[model samples]
Target: MTSPLHTTRRAFTWMLGTALVGGASACGLSGTGGRGVIFRMGLRTAKAPGEESPGEFTTDTGWRIRLSSGVMVLGPIYIFENASPLEPTASAPRVLQRLGQWLLPTAHAHDGHFFSGGTVLGEWDREVVFDLLEEAGEVRELGRSPGIAGLARSFSLLLQPPSRALGAEGAALGGRSMILEGTASRQETHVPFRMALDFPPPVELQRVDFVPIAAELDEGGRFVVEVQPHRWFDGAHFDRVTVPEGGGVVDLTPDTQVYRALTLNVRRYTAFAGTWEPA
Candidate 1:
């Protein structure tokens, strides 16, 4: 089978910048003795011009919205060491399977962790489930694996709902993958809205890629997989939705107008703008 495609990126920046860490030939597939690499990752909101942070913004529809609780389950971040293999005959890099994979496959998201693949040097496990909104504003730790060897040409991220694998015991997230509880207001009308996004494994498989741009991971480099929250509501139409009387709560269940908008919103926003690393 053909290997995953590779992309080239000259430079990436927003409020943050993706710098060129570990030089081109810094390190590749090291053995027992060598300067190991620290793999860091996190989720951050896009920096709005006037705003200091990403959340707490208004939509184009004139409806003011804010995230009351933005709890989410994300995981299985695979960093492809040699994504673009020079040759097919080259032996696959070794995978140092960690013990129990961050608590084991049976672990929960609360105290347990669902670690995916192990490291290349047959050392520690590299993947884990993270509460993206749990530790907002701060760069939460992702696990560390020695030997930041080779070029991390590309990486794939798998974000799912609260599961035994995700280590989050469905935070009141009954029958849904993503639970978005917030309030929307228009003029003098303030309505509470609860949007439950159903992520049936298949939809949870979206990837953030910078193709045609050679985005490589460097040693001692810190990378964050940021998700722009506001981007999720891009091109969404709220004026067309019909809110229930009295309650004024817009329940965005599946198949509803607002529901469809939420679905498309995620699809459009769930992508990497580019790689950026602050000095």
Candidate 2:
């Protein structure tokens, strides 16, 4: 006859071995071969529809503006598996469905929220500085990164200053995230303006999040981000700009109305769009 304690110890050992084997099998099935896709990424700027010239457009306030130079620092892009609630698919029914899921006892047990920021499918955490005027009709490749195969529903990126390693591009920014040199004219008034924008203290990362995009990310895919610089001046009141005496280019300070408008418009979702292409 066997002792009861010895038999119980043996049973415990067998159960532990079975659990370890099951865990290993699950890991092998989900981890080893799931994230094998590689994606290339690029950035560029383009003229919005109805604009005949690359850097010249008429603002809504009747100011004909021509940008002589434009540069911006953008990076640390992240692609997510879930779409934003503002997207077309997020209707009244979808909200109710998510509410039902949230009501479940097991729903709150998961990591992340019920509505926003789903699993990260891919990321490029490098800061890149690109010339908006130079990339107007061309695409500049911003290195590749590994990604998992999934439906990329939305993406986000940071609009911080360029790294010092970016050399001249970084220096041109002068610790600012964006700089634009342009001249705006309305009737008899012409004002040449230089706008330098930077996010100051307490505002570390100027993240533009949840820009809706749909992409079936698979092998050899390329993600392209298109920026519309003209749209940045949509609500700008150029008439409010103080013209310097003797006709020098006016430097737009943070207090100016036009500068404030540009700052807000630059971060708007309509100013940027994303698309995926085959590599």
Candidate 3:
């Protein structure tokens, strides 16, 4: 049997869901891998109606996101914002579904070890997906997994100005920012996109520090920018990142193995412009 502490860590890691993968690296730049550069990222939560509380026995729809190793650096960005009529099975009040969106920018890597060579984020369209085991005794199962523990260590919010990573100034003062843009879990091409942030880069391991900013959903179930934070994906990849000198182009061909495990359908896109501010 897994230790209670370990199980809890895993659960907490996935609670952030897809945000955990990309949370370690932002600005479309990979980390130094060897800890030479402290990868700091800050992220805000994109809240919606169903996210707060699942209304009386409804299908609580949410998202569970996982990424490939390479995608971790390039980021597909996971999001679970936006809820439906799905009902939660757990007695835990947190059993309600959550709604939000996320974004990811093309990232550059110098050494393959940085944020390169793996899935960055994975997303599930429903929060129930993570409700794997419902025994109340297993509630702590979420705090175990080293991966989850690693994700928690990657976020923070202790600074003079609350280090919300809601603005460039705060991020600059703190180090880096990782704003969530939106999430896509279904096969349809019409999903709404919400945004948030992750700061500092290479989050300190096993530390719990993340502040969530709520976003309002539009009449059409789409998200409208309510609390605009710092920058989404770091100013649309505005900052110049350094790749290895003469490093060959990164082969981003999607691996079927990683795809199936993460359960995400890949797509090529070209629209990143939007009506929001860089916090």
Candidate 4:
């Protein structure tokens, strides 16, 4: 058997590689550009100590995400008071493994559609799911090729049009609040396949206004939306935003995983624009 010290060393090395393969920068990923729209968002997740059926578990936690935006891309630079198991054991790595995947590269939205990176260990158990901005094509699924980095590397190969064309159709904006209504007809493994995240009841998506916000236009005419959370997970949260310019950004704050789930969308909005920091 490997010594504990050796095991720790291996874990550390593995984690480092994991961070590289799954981190935000690995894929030349960056925030979008625009007149940044910032928001203070509240989020909650559920978890439990005992095991459920195979490949499942329960957990519970919540957080508030402070998000900044560019026209199209959002990058979550911080996270706070999230929750997840510290290590993986024989029974399963359910929570930790899933958290690993999320923090790794589970979902990324671009142009209007969403692409998911499902496996980091090559072909051991890798998959990718796509969500389109329209309502025509069926959900496309691609099996990963052999290799630990195949899924991440072969990302471009799995391409399909969004079932519906993404448009400004019902998208509307107000003073500090805005709403864009769209549908994802296919079942996505974006959140729940590996874990269950629970939020408060009366969960519904609606228009919300983030006050005290501002927008700073850059030389490229891109805006970097910034905000400070009124409240957040350990005072932080993960946020996704659509940049007026075109793409979107996933504003990641320093966070820990408490649980996981599907059918829940956490969001944030800001009133004033400035460089964001811990408040």
TM-score ranking from best candidate downward: 2, 1, 4, 3
Every model: Cα RMSD to truth? 13.7, 12.8, 22.6, 22.1
Task: Supply the TM-score for candidate 1.
Answer: 0.59
lDDT of each: 0.44, 0.70, 0.22, 0.22
Please list the residue runs of candidate 3 whose C-alpha ends up more than 4 Å from where it truly belongs after superposition. Answer: 1-4, 8-211, 217-220, 223-279
Error of 1 at 238 (Å): 1.8
Tens-digit per-residue lDDT, 13-38, candidate 4: 34324543454233233334211222
lDDT of 2 by residue, 22-48 (tens): 433433355332444789888878776
How does residue 108 of candidate 4 score in lDDT? 39
What is the per-residue lDDT of model 3 for residues 136-204, given as tens digits with 9 covering 90 to 100?
A: 112211111112111110111111112332344344323322222222232332222222222222222
Top-lDDT candidate index: 2
lDDT string for model 1 (1-279, tens) is: 321121111111110011112321233335422244554554554543465555566776767667676655444444433232221122443332222121222211121111111122111222243343456556665545333444444444444455554334554556455667677667876767778776454422332321111334445555665655665665556666677876756787776676777665553313333242422
- Is candidate 2 or 3 superior in lDDT? 2
Task: Output the worst ten-in-a-row residue range by lDDT, candidate 1.
Answer: 10-19
Per model, state how many residue pairs clash. 20, 0, 90, 73
Regions more than 4 Å wrong, model 4: 1-163, 166-204, 216-220, 226-265, 268-279
The C-alpha TM-scores of every prediction are 0.59, 0.76, 0.17, 0.17
